[model samples]
Target: MRRTSLLAATGALLLSAAPAAAAQPQVRIHDIQGTTRVSPLVGKHVADVPGVVTGVRASGASRGFWFQDPNPDNDPRTSEGLFVYTGDKDPAVAVGDAVTVSGVVSEYYPLSSGETPETTANQSVTELTGASWQVTGKGSVPAEEIGPDTVPQAYAAPDGNIEKTQLDPARYALDYFESREGMVLRVDDARVVGPTDTHRSLWVTTKPEQNRNPRGGTTYTGYADANSGRLKVESLAGGDFPAADVGDRLRGGTEGPLDYSSYGGYVLEANALGQHVPGGLKPETTRKQADGELSVATYNVENLAPSNDPAKFQRLAEGVVRGLAAPDIVAVEEVQDNSGPEDDGVVDASQTLTKLTDAIAAAGGPHYQWRQINPQNDADGGQPGGNIRVAFLFNPNRVSFMDKPGGDATTPVRPVADGGHAALSTSPGRIAPTDDAWKDSRKPLVGQFEFRGAPVFVVADHFASKGGDQPMHGRFQPPTRSSEEQRTAQSRLVRGFVDDLRRVDGGARAVVLGDLNDFGFSPALAPLTDGGALTDLATTLPPAERYSYVYEGNSQQLDHTLVTPGVRADYDIVHLNAEFHDQTSDHDPQVTRIQP
Candidate 1:
């Protein structure tokens, strides 16, 4: 934590020493102690220690250069701002570069990370900052030191040794019998065992529960006998078997006969598990013709990117205004705002949505107003060039906005433990962990509105997470500790919110909508469903049309519209067109007509 001021005059040494240089100072060190540094380090000794290059910004009017190095760890010892130096140099620096310098370390006072470092604060530079000391040619190492030249071999299973197994009703427990924690095996013929709990259960006669070793990377599948509920077959591997209904099958690996009582049950990882099959629904189209009836819809719009420019932020307010039949309210998720310097002057997403509201007005639709919760700049994930978010559009004619809301509607939304890691692991079109800025960017938008003369509470949410083939950290079925904690907290918060709403009007009519970021069958939605506070209308639609987004060419619904039991009979939840998967929107607009 070197705290001092970096004087601009400090860089004068390298600038002056350059012309009459003897061997040309090859190394430069611009100490970023308390202020900004601005200088070039082509052939100077440049030094910086344990810092992340936030970015490379060009200096003003002079084609000069400087790099931003922010302290990655929240350490008080490290300074924040740009380190600058000067010399006739080509440093070849890039964003996210980490380096160490051994030149004079100076401090600059009265500066901030907000403005350019050198211009606002004291700056210093070492004459020999970035000099290259040594050069090595290719193949310089001894052949023996380079290691063996043999091609790595893979273990090939003996022919006909890979066996497939199926389960029958009488052998329902067999699925738990064959799987072992660390050995990767395949399962066939598996079906979703139960919706018994919020964590959807997948039952496979040939698959057992696998749990990760809390201390190491090993995994195991555990078998428990039905007769005594005692553990058996701690680990099993080598084969392709399916765990499904009596006849269905799929292949998967096994790693555990986990201690069910100690760490809950063993988690099962399906070898070739398909997405959860949507539940059956009674098909009936019901239209509302009441004079003041309002049709509201909420859609997740999974990774909706402007055509040809997946990362570019396109304003959808116009499409939302013009594409569908006029609805009183529409809640959307994954709205983006590309306003940063990184976006290269593309349309700001917030501006785009603003235009969408204007489009609604222009289309002779109701005068629609909108609200959104923008995550902190650091919170970004999901798709490239897109900032995932949740927003609400309200028609002034149908509902009047409350001047001040009760809850903090702008906080970053948290994910439930079960859904967190899985959701964050499978965000499309972007790298994981690195692109986790928007992982919790979404927040539930709660507003008070008049629903047909009666005041109703409308809460729109976009839950934390994304889709993933494997659990967080490749932990077996269920999920790992980290992912589970996040999702559990998320669920508790949502449940608390819903409970508060019920207490507001003695459990009056309420509607919850948006991309919950979980399937209809996920336990995350249990609070609303089990409490009978909300009705899941998405489950009432056919499977083919139920999915709002597709992954690996398979369709699965993540968008939803739910209403309270009090008003469930008064409205018909309709799953509109979803067949046009990639055309208008990734999610099909769900239209719900509620009686006034």
Candidate 2:
């Protein structure tokens, strides 16, 4: 998706000159392209360029067509193809038509206009603006094939300097996109990684044997190492493209004109797409309740608010009741303020909870009671006005919440002895709320509960998101994750709290569970696992079934349930979401059975 920015400046490259009767000089497409990403002859008028039409798009902010030279020069960095932008006017150019075009060269940046605007410099698409076209002949245009087999591994260099990336299509994805920009690309038998975006952009990987996770899906191991095989296919030429899910395959091949967009990075503007082959991953069956076992699940409901459709609340209730087997307690994250996304100084979410709990009862589930500490106004980071925070939903009939006072947004909860038993000073308080590590992120919610006369302490956390982290396929070779440091400190704080409980009572049962926002294999998680105070339950599962989230065709874990010693736990990562097209969240709900 495109980041929010003002439109970029579009210079008048084409001058209104009188029609010339004499034949204009013919220039090769590569000469106008010059060897740099920014065209050398930008703002200069050129004429009588001959090429065969490879693809055409007659709609949207980018209304144009693509053509490729029949013959090319010696410079591999110079592209053989070019785009002719008609600017809301129809050029009447069809695919397979050999035509001569006369126009001024220009560089189009999606968002570089206005007084204070943002532009993707050195990444703008070069094109022929305000162009006039004449058909010379009609014939078939062969497209440049791009797949795992066609692209050379040697050319897969590193991404950075535009000069070095001229022909390094095999080593880096950005280089590959630049080298083939504005040309027709054909991908045969590619696998879909990410689902279609709002602009109908589909991400796919040419290498079916790409480095996969233990769950038979892709994983983000490193920067270039993880995303060298993926590509984004955008269909802005109009008409609906079929929606796809992770692990789905595109059979019969997909072809499109390669172009650049500010939001989607480099994309193939598809006029046609192949048939969608399903991944055969179905919804999971509900978990069965056992006699001596108490089920606790953590679900990130994805910013649920009172303003959302009542039907949305109903669907979530069904998932909680059916998919999670009506767990005795659910650590819910992303519960928004009652006013939803509207930032009106409203902080309480009692109305939001009322609607959700009402739906659970109507769906034949236990009447669940929720507890949470509302962050001051916009203290917790998430949707600006939404005031998203972590909460807990427990069945009052099954478990009793030990109610105590002294809990608020800024107050830090500490472990204290209650009737000779280890307990929290505040029943449902925040853990290290004022810590610098949690500057603007969601704070951990701690609670004390008694299930069947056994005391259990729980901490529900929603850590800092990976928004500012460098992408897996960025200019840097091994991209740096700026968000990891904050998450590491937060993890250590939570681990320290768990260790505190153990110090009070050697046989204390504590659970730390929520959307951790860090991978199970990442070094960022070492602080929580290194000391052995707690163990991530995902480590106990077979590698093939350890994931709780599916992203870019990779089965990974961003949510986890870590427990202390003497707490025998059995967890099931429900696959009702992530792998399916219809999902309330990108993460699958996970249920853990704890015998305290």
Candidate 3:
């Protein structure tokens, strides 16, 4: 590729008429888009970059015009397009106008509120700044197509190094973005995976088939693979655009310059969007299981604090009654303290549970009795002062709690043989409370109950979250899941408790439910499901419908339920939340009915 190093000097003329004046060196647009994320000639001044203006963002605080070379070099590692940042200058250059500009090459990163002025993990976008351009000639913009055939595979190369020279441009999203950083490209017949963000950024995919998940976008289940086909389309035309829901298709696709932003990775700032194709997804109806069978459910009530919007409590109650059919017991996660988001020493969620139970009753459901142990102040890892802990809401008429002196927050509950039946030493107790595996994470809440004269044991758990994991588009090829180690240990601990119950009685009706935080297919769950001691009901569902949570664009299962043999259980994931735009919780409640 051609490379030119320009000195940071005053504006120099490309062609000097004076015999004594030296001619300024010219650099190809591809040269400015170096082999890496940062330009090779960054901080240096370059003159006479000839290309056609593809698109322009004249207004806004971060405004720039997109330009591309009509004829590109055969080097696939370098992009032929570049963005010229015109600070408050109403550039007279129009689309299709060939322009020769002079500018200092530099990388620009938009600072987040309270963010420092240095490049950390979050801020990483390269751009050209302090530019001045002049229209040279007029020509039609290039219409190069980048479809499924050209995009990279969802998973990065097996090699661990992201900085390794990009051998193939259409193999990984990171490599593809590096190869075509500023190039003007088109995604024909793309499918919208997620609705537009507040900044009008829409996530879409040109390949809707190959590595596609049942729910529009791709998944990170097995190999932590990302959907390389998925791309973000940012429209800076300065007006409200109708948002597209998941499964919607964009015929003719989007055509624009691919750029990077701090919030989202490489995005195609679309100048034109094609025809809209509706996905035709309808809301699911309430479920109906056989009567007389005690039904239980698991729901992560997304930081349901008392100070939250009153409508949130109402919506959750409606979802529990109408959507989930008001299960006999609900293993609720993220139940903040009575003070809600307030950071006082208060750890009781009685007021929060009472408000929720009262709402359920108002919604024509039976009055629900709740049980939980208030966590130590700031001990449980959730919103600070929120003291989020797992709790159970049970209908006394259907099933009654087998109370045997509940354990405190720091007390660990041990399994004991009770009249040849498996029984917890302490009801509504914490399992392995002081275990290092649960070091700042939520502890498993164990409760024993009697359903129709038969004793059943249930455990409510909220394992370590996947927040500490690396992004799919990080420097590591297959991003390491550092959070899985702690979760695996936590799973083993729960399984040990479950095995104890089964040891007391092989025919034990043990039910494990709540927001496990790990996927059913992830290796972190092998400890619980490997030997078949516990069967995950979600895995038995049709693969496409196995998810209970929607993140980014993939509908995945973060909440799960496992039951012992002889306990015939059927599950129904109430899709009232997650998929819908107006959601009270990020997770859909999973209802399981146990027929004794």
Candidate 4:
């Protein structure tokens, strides 16, 4: 429900102290320094400011260079410039070089953190034109001499208050490094804890110290060696640097080796950070049905909800029972529910689907039945509308629900972390779930059905959203944390499932349908077609009728129904009324008739 904006910057404007002076054509260092304010200037040209380079640190392949006024006492405003660091050029300015930089002060770009608000602190820099010269002035001293020495702060600490407990060295070292964020802290009596395949490093433990606040209130303080503490850096300027040893003095802000949490953490690389990881439920084989005629259809029942009041369950029984096609098997996506009354509230979608089955039979339609995989009670992803899921509706006369294999039949489904959770997988990418991670909800539902006299299998898939397309590429920027990869994996798993079925029953039939979160031509759909397992129904229609959703005022097809080669031969896939583009659902329905 929270529509993600793929826009690069949030369009946040920093208020400036005053308007640009009319007399000056270009902004000068004095103009920026004279004003005690910041402004948002997306495409403005500014003049160069000269200062002494106080610090130069290589970040990945780029260098973060900081500068201070020649007369620090006279000019209080500090300035800095960042440049992409290529190894070919010797850095013109060292720690003590005087350099002048001319570039526009730009707004910070936001980084994605699954389930967290995007973070903004680092700004982007471009068009660097500067000169550097060696300075004969006194050099800046290292950070340690400026402050008093103390024990390094450990990453994790015991639950008990630090003041009362005696420090246990071994356990202390193990826990601290595990809990601390990316920051530098001094440690005492530190020892090598473990070694990773890439580097050998030590985890140090330190005791807490008591300190007084500005109001003379006492508090506990921790330390780091040589002012040594963890500093989260985006990356090293170059690759494969030597690891810091156990006894090595660590400067609090000095960049160090990457940590486990680094991938989804604060210091992520610009290129890799804030991306969605893909994931999904992997399908298990179900019972095969006997040969018989069956009917299957896919519907994009636009945003079907329980009611205006999110608290009340919207009755879908009437709609399903009275639907024009009266499908024997229905794959409905975007069936919405929510935690609040104003939003799509707690209408049990499974129960609604069940009611619809009974309603259809009562209305002289087929005696249909249904099954659904509900998202977790706590899985609140979509915006104010609550949550949406795909449900399977089938005629009992056509198919029987088989117990999913390889798992306890009665065992309750568990809510594994979605791409939103960092601890779930280490792939550094998000893919849709292909397993039973959807015990709570927010996953595709699968089942086996008997079509009159033949066996048929179906997977009701509702992929992640391709909400906003990227301006430059005209493609939906996949979600952060490898989310696109997870979806890709889910597609592959579906293809594999279909392939396995064909292998078992030389001419087995299968159907895949719902909102795929992808276009007909997307790379994610390759697996389904590559093995000749599924054929897209949209391809049967003329170019004008292909799309089901609209973006940037243009209609695009995202909802689809695909059939296996064996199934397509006997069934005619039809796209229903989609021209209205109404609010009932974001997608129109597509019905398929299986011949006897």
- Model 3 — TM-score against the truth? 0.88
| Residue 102 accuracy (lDDT) in model 2 | 72
Model 2 lDDT per residue over 99-145, tens place: 87778898776553331213223256789986776678985556677
Candidates in order: C-alpha RMSD to true structure: 21.3, 5.3, 4.2, 23.6
Model 4 residue 470 CA deviation (Å) reads: 3.6
Q: What residue runs in model 1 are displaced by over 4 Å at the alpha carbon?
A: 1-289, 301-324, 338-349, 361-364, 384-386, 405-439, 467-485, 542-545, 569-578
Q: Candidate 1's residue-wise lDDT over 1-596, tens digit each?
A: 11112442355445676766466333212232211112233233343333332222233221112222332224322223333332344344443345433344322222234544333211122122322211111111011010111111111112221112221212222122222111122333222221112122233222222221111101211111111111212111224222222112222332221211111222332222433333332222335335566667675555543332422223233344444455677877776664432444343456646655665666566677776544545354455446656667777766665434222223322211222111111111111122232254455565555665565556676666643222211113222223333444555655565665455445465677876666666555566577666788766654334555432122355667778766743333333322221233545456676664
Stretches off by above 4 angstroms in model 4 are: 1-293, 302-305, 308-324, 336-351, 354-367, 379-387, 397-441, 467-483, 569-582
In order, the Cα lDDT scores of the candidates are 0.39, 0.77, 0.77, 0.40
Number of the top TM-score candidate: 3
Model 4 alpha-carbon miss at residue 10, Å: 37
lDDT of 1 at 95: 33
Candidate achieving higher lDDT, 1 or 3? 3
Worst 10 residues of 4 by lDDT: 422-431
Instruction: Rank the candidate models, highest TM-score first.
Output: 3, 2, 1, 4
Output the TM-score of candidate 4: 0.43
Worst 10 residues of 1 by lDDT: 139-148
The local distance difference test score of model 3 is: 0.77
Residue 274, model 4: lDDT of: 15
For residues 1-596, write the lDDT of model 3, one tens digit per residue. Answer: 11112432222443343367565566988888877666778788887788998888877666678888887888888888888876666655678888877778887755545555352333245466777666778966576687667776655665664544454565666777767877788988788776554556667776677445555644444455555666778775556564676667788757888887655567888878877787775444456556668798999999988788889988888888888888889999999998987887999888899989999999888799988998888888987789999999999988899887869899999888888777888898999898899988899999998888888888999999987675565545566788999999999999999988788788888889888898888899899987899999987776667777765566678999999877787778777676654567878888988874
